[model samples]
Target: MQATKRPDFIDQQYDFAAYIRNPEHNAAPDGIETRRMAIYRDLFYNNIENFAASAFPVIRAITSDERWHAMIRDFMVKHHCKTPLFLEIAQELLDYLQNEREPQADDYPFLLELAHYEWVELALSISEESAIGEDVDPNGDLITGIPQLSPLAWPLSYHYPVHRIGPEQIPDGETETHLVVYRDRHDAVHFLEINAVTARLLQLIQQNVAASGRELLESIATEMNHPQPQQIVSVGAEILLDLRHRDLLTGIHNIPER
Candidate 1:
């Protein structure tokens, strides 16, 4: 049998992979030929690591710096993400926490929501497409006439008030927050605190239910034992008018188009 001879490419590629993963693996190439390759590999990983660190300051703040760096190192080794956008890195971290990380749900049930809420702000700001609400009649009764929500508007209730989430305020048990997240006519993001009834009403209108704004208000009033559709609509219409003035209504026109 011929004597075994190591291929040059095998040695180079081995050094390349190791140098890429960590600088400590740098072995003298016995020549200046391979030194430049190792330097380039280290620089590439450093740039990537720095970018990830900057993109996720809140997450980084939640962990010790050493732990944070270690976390990023392991993540780089294990996961292959599809997006090159640094803003999307939080999404990947969230997915990892949900599927792979073992953070206790009782103590950190809101971790996922916090990440998502933070990401939402960035997502809306960078979205390439935008939409504005359709024509709406402010004088029309909402409970009697079906009201349509803006396509850019959303009502989201999270298990935790993620806006308040941080290392200091994170509760030891589950919490909930009711919020309306929407984009205005100028495409700026706006968030509001809303009650359960209002959130449900928005959901119903968004689903294109036949109930009019006045009818919905009356239902809310009845639940509170007020039982007056007209009064309820009067108050609800004022609220809807404010939302419309703010461009939160996609369309509020009454039926029959008069």
Candidate 2:
């Protein structure tokens, strides 16, 4: 007896979906008209392409139209995004650029970093975390109290000056770029470029939430082997105050009186 054959309908559905996703590589379903298939293909691809362009405006501006379209096509065809959410599609593109896509000579070396930098603002804007809480004291003493980094605040470091990259401002050499991206109380996302020391100070606060601002500064001063620890403490206090004012530090951690 001959083996049973699978129904053509199932195969046709798979073929049609594949063609819509990648017309260049896959053929149209056997019976479907080319014109109709083209409509589906264009619709699907255009939506994704438009979303990517909007999400990574800097990347789209810097790359040639030909290259940008090719990159989007590659992402559409190659990357199997896990999330069904539209917002997450941008993140999927970033993941593809960072881990899957091979670098091309014409592509900027900071392409992935810049894409990530752009995504950060969108991500922070949609984050569910509150900027400040009832437990936080906005006017707490920086020197005596534990400083709390806001959940919406992120300290990020990149090898390239991603924040400054644009069509005409491509950096020549790699430099350590330290940035703090935060959502303020007003629900606005802000980015601040800081030196390595300030970045480290934020990291210390993040790592040791129980440490008072003065203790954190003392630790930093010890690490730096500063000749005058008091001066470091003073400067560090000012830094803490600035961060607090910027809403990067939610406020001090309130401990009950003993």
Candidate 3:
């Protein structure tokens, strides 16, 4: 079947947008004045670059001016963004980095992970997700009761220590870095680095949501073949309390006593 032709107005709009997004590659539409087009070009590109700079401040700071602008230009030119909203621009950029970005010799090996870390901070700050639930008890026994992991708390493992990357130094080597990025009740975002053991414990809690905190700790001990499982339980209890204090654990799930 033959495809229907798009309206001339649609083609004109596409030409205008294409040139504005990547003026170096695409020419301005037939009759548009260069002076008028310059305003749109600067306005559109600057808006995107400013937002990208804000969303990924660490990336912006550590990256050279030419490299940073090149990256933003590539994003605008190549990545097909899905949303038109400004708040979602960070997420869109993340999508571009993860899936669409072409590899470059000058790009940091940890660029993707670093972008994700930055995006998570912005995402959690603006998130409207609620931790409030009728089935959660603020002061319930973490060990004896089923603990509710806060949706606001994210458990992430990266090959690089994304949190440590900044203007000071790029660092030397990569290792398995586990972190929990969370938004507390006060709406402040925090990045907490945890050991491998703590990471596994959180993983167990997320997977076995119905199990009591004691059961979760015991499972970890069993997995490790630790003879003194009670010690694990004791220490894990303290860790749970610490998480509660930090608002990472939304407290114990208020399942009715059988």
Q: Order candidates by lDDT, high to low.
A: 3, 2, 1
For each candidate in the order shown, give its overall lDDT on alpha carbons. 0.67, 0.89, 0.91
Candidate 2 clash figure, as a count: 0
lDDT of 3 at 176: 92
lDDT value, residue 57 of candidate 2: 92
How are the candidates ranked when ordered by TM-score, highest leading? Answer: 3, 2, 1
TM-score (all chains, Cα) for each model: 0.71, 0.92, 0.95
User: Which candidate comes out best when scored by lDDT?
Assistant: 3
lDDT of 3 at 224: 91
lDDT of 1 by residue, 78-158 (tens): 566678877777667656655666554333456567666666666666666445435666455555677877766768889
Model 3 misplaced regions, further than 4 Å: 1-5, 255-258
* lDDT at residue 225 of model 3 (Cα atoms): 99
Off by over 4 Å in 1: 1-55, 104-107, 133-145, 219-231, 253-258
Q: What tens digits encode model 2's per-residue C-alpha lDDT throughout 81-184?
A: 99988898889999999988889988777887899999999899889987776678878897888888899999999999999888889899899999999999
